[model samples]
Target: MGTDVNRKAKHILIVGGGYVGLYTALRLQRRLSRELRDGSVRITLATPESYMTYQPFLPEAAAGNLSPRHVVAPLRRVLPKVRIINGKITKVNHAAKTATFQPADGPRRDIAYDIIVMAAGSISRTLPIPGLTDIGIGFRTVGEAIGLRNRVLHQLDVAESVDDPDLRRRALTFVVVGAGFAGVEALAELEDMSRDSIRYYRNLSPRDLRWVLVEATDRVLPEVGPEMGRWTLEQLRERGIDVRLNTRLESCVGGKVVLSDGDVFEADTLVWTAGVRANPIIESSDLPIDERGRIKTTTWLTVAGVRDAFAAGDIAGVPDATNPGRFCAPNAQHAVRQAKVLADNIVRTLRGEELVGYRHRYVGSVAGLGLHKGVANVYGIKLRGFPAWFMHRTYHLSRMPTFNRKVRVVVDWTLALLFKRETISLGEIHHPRDEFRAAVATGRKH
Candidate 1:
């Protein structure tokens, strides 16, 4: 949608820049370039950022195993023909077939579109738990991953410098709330990295480090089945990880985690990765949403009751045909598969071809347990330890989208096999403005 245009090839406006949005855009970009009848198909992707952060690599980014910069794709670079606007869609008027947007640095604007794809993704689902707003670190973004790394490294410094045992203990203890992929893998990878890092620091040993995982549910990685969940728990327990299942973080006033199980632990780090809810922006849009606040979509990925509107990913509650009883789970695998289907459906609608329904079975789940240990259950086959870990890397690498990116990621892994993991922390970048302000204030005083 733009200032003036005879709608050519039926303009496609994709909202959101996360998994579903990016994948859909990528596929559409290639398809449009190669297959479109007359370049009549105009694609525009509008989102808050001109980049897409690969969420799956956040754990590796947190552990400093992968550079955070390597986990993002610049939208403009990947899809040159596609108009990439840095903005957020504030309203969607399906009746008029238009969306209102607020740009990064301009007046508000309206976009009239022929077709709309709402992939506005999910946000970190947070509760009003005491002190969570200020203390809990989210596990959804690359920035948070880099921040967590700095905090972990600095915590090691705190442990080394402090003479008080209690202070050292508090600094060394890292608490992660949530046993999902983000929390579990982050805890595992960081713990593994930190344990390896102790050789450089004479004051701390692997035994001195405390890694705690607290989950409200009775098990971790529930998608991997009860057996796998139980097995994963045992593995964590065997590594001295204090996994508190059927427990909740009641309060964390002043870095002390008070659990529902009537136990208390003090730690400087609190990571929140319990789950994600639809992005709050959807609530403001003129569309029907489910009880959980997700856009309801049919088997064909069209907005359940709205014509010309389609959505996919975490924000869209897409009905699962294979299961027939539930919505598609908001995981990377589903999101990737749904994007392809959603893109094809959009193109189909433009070409006057019949839109096909989205149908795919759950292809099992995988978890990387750090330092070359892993767990996975794919197509009814279960794997654990090194085998599972190898599969985990392989699956994610293969599914990493572009062939160019795939090669770069594989190169990173190959280099990692030969060289030691980089433990350098870039904490300074987080507070560049603060340092400038302080320097200016001090200069005035002088």
Candidate 2:
């Protein structure tokens, strides 16, 4: 039975609400509204959240410069014409042309659509490091950002207490592993925030804080060249950050971190921004995937050997044509650009036109180190310090999707210029449980 073209519009279901999914839907609404209105196409975007978080700003969110909510865009507002179904896809029955999803509120619902776009983005890649789930916090989502902010400030609070040097050292020490964009930005931002916050707590000083960054690789930000990584290392070390290259984190017990470099460091806070893996949604689906579990897609964003199905972003192993037997590197720039190509390809497929593949050579790489500092390499040029920082903000703000959001972010920056940054900590949110328990105990005793 072919798709019923006489009924409601031909359904195009997009899974995952991250950069690729949301942008593709937005482009569809902007370009294909006529098709949707004339009963030619019906578009629906099914994602776990109603927003797409611009991940580049997440480290700044952890640092408290950008509001976590501001980092994400509400899908309904951007693509109001498209149906926004909030759910996490568990199974994709491509043969049946249907996908099973567990909604945010309701029971699992099986949705049938004529076409599907698997843009399910990546998840925080974590290893089975002992005591990680219980003692460590991830740096992926807005929730994790908030949690890290709370945890960092809470560590300060713990350090401000009574006279046990051992305990104080543990409270003040913060261990961060991985030197990629996420790790470097996070370490720099959090360290800057915590250092500034010490003024509010008289007992905690900048010297008391021991921030360590461990990277198994020889240097940080492999996306950038080694020269830039060395420059970043210089900048970080200048700010008193201990950047350990060619070092591995052997294990992290209750709070103490053991490095393969034979250094045993004790700390109360351990943040893992190591890396990310493709979304597990692929494994559940009856789709062909590469060894890395990414759906093998052709140059035009079409899944190999699959009909009317497409994928992009971190989840799809797009063949990097230039590098034989290799896939396109996963990053935000590709995800954003790939969305346009993917949307165009889908439209072309609908109209029986020829499709083009997605190919974007990395234009540049940039990283923000707390306030007023950064590094970048664009179009064969490398920059550092204030200029790179300015470029970073300008590029991201321009590419931040909506004008409304861009204005808000720019305004935030302006206000920051006029007023000193706010370093007040909101660390008590995590200790409410302990307070409640203590209150209950006191009442029972009385």
Candidate 3:
């Protein structure tokens, strides 16, 4: 009877490569090593990228304080026992126990599995303001962070080289929408980097740059509470950053920013870090989802009213047991912790044991506002300035995926203290084949 129970073969399919997907797989690999070795259990993770990006460090990476490569962990190296597929799980047919996998360079195919983990994370939630799509960029991925860095530095170069005052003014104006963690940190880091870079340019000065932050809400960093948010606002205003609260971006037609307060300006750079919505892939699946489009999950991390299906992270509407009548916030704090519980439950189910529910108290929030500046509220303990900044770094460093990545990030920070931030923009990297194409055309003519 024992051998029969242990010999049962099962396959687990995990979709998405973000925090929940990566961590859950890591935990399951360790828990099911014997089953894997005996060919009684198999795990396959499908993700759009081969590596998992630690989004919390993106701001530092954008400011050139950390290398881009160090912010992401290669999934293959971390999960050697699991099968990694570089693709997207386009759709999940739970009734049929199969998911449609669309590989990076091939036709779509169906993957059969005994259990499915819907870890497909959220995407940037965008609005339909005029010219917003054309002019705006987001700060979710490492590419966007590094790209925004290049764009900012490139704009400075344009401003310096141009003789037209209007063009130069437009080039120097940077507008960031939303005052959440992403928007605030991104604005602060880039502004700090740009301020440091101005000393090298003879024509540009700190006064020449205009940094504007637009938000519809009356406060910033709502996660840290109103008092700390107010403090953060004051700090930014003191740094000459224009913080517009309770205001809406009416439009940005032809680079002309028309605000709800009748303010008008031309800005070449517009960053939209407002929010994110659950991945549309959830809609394609047969899983039951809430009105917000997130898969409804029980405290045990299992999909509501569905057998052999589980979900966690930003894509799941997981009820917060700690806060009655509320769901868990879509953040790294919940995702990381929930993943451990999720993995353990899966192991329990395989062993015919009782599953465990996931519950954890909200620890609080921490945010970095450039070098030696930050705000944090941990367990109701409020902190600001250098102390908060140090706490933010230490907490995130402790959470950063692997020890290998943690060491690289520390080295990057140490080097930044010894050297000035590099402001050179390698924009040509976005179009590497352009020069080769031009050469080919010349060769054909010759």
Winner on TM-score (1 vs 2): 1
Give candidate 1's root-mean-square deviation (CA, Å).
Answer: 1.9
lDDT of 3 by residue, 286-398 (tens): 99999888999999999999988999999999999999899999999999999999999999988889999989899999999998899999999999999999999999999
Ranking by lDDT: 3, 1, 2
- Ranking by TM-score, best first? 3, 1, 2
**Residues 98-198 of candidate 1: C-alpha lDDT, one tens digit per residue:** 78888977788788888899999989898889988877899888889889988888888889998999999999999999998888998998888888787
In candidate 2, list every pair of residues with a backbone clash.
125-276, 299-357
Error of 1 at 311 (Å): 0.7
For all predictions, the C-alpha RMSD in Å is 1.9, 2.8, 3.5
Candidate 1 segments whose C-alpha is farther than 4 A from its true place: 1-9, 34-39
Model 2 poorest ten-residue lDDT run: 1-10
Candidate 2, backbone clash total: 2
lDDT of 2 at 228: 95
Which residue segments of model 2 deviate by more than 4 Å?
1-7, 428-446
User: All candidates' lDDT scores?
Assistant: 0.86, 0.86, 0.94
Question: Model 3 TM-score?
Answer: 0.97
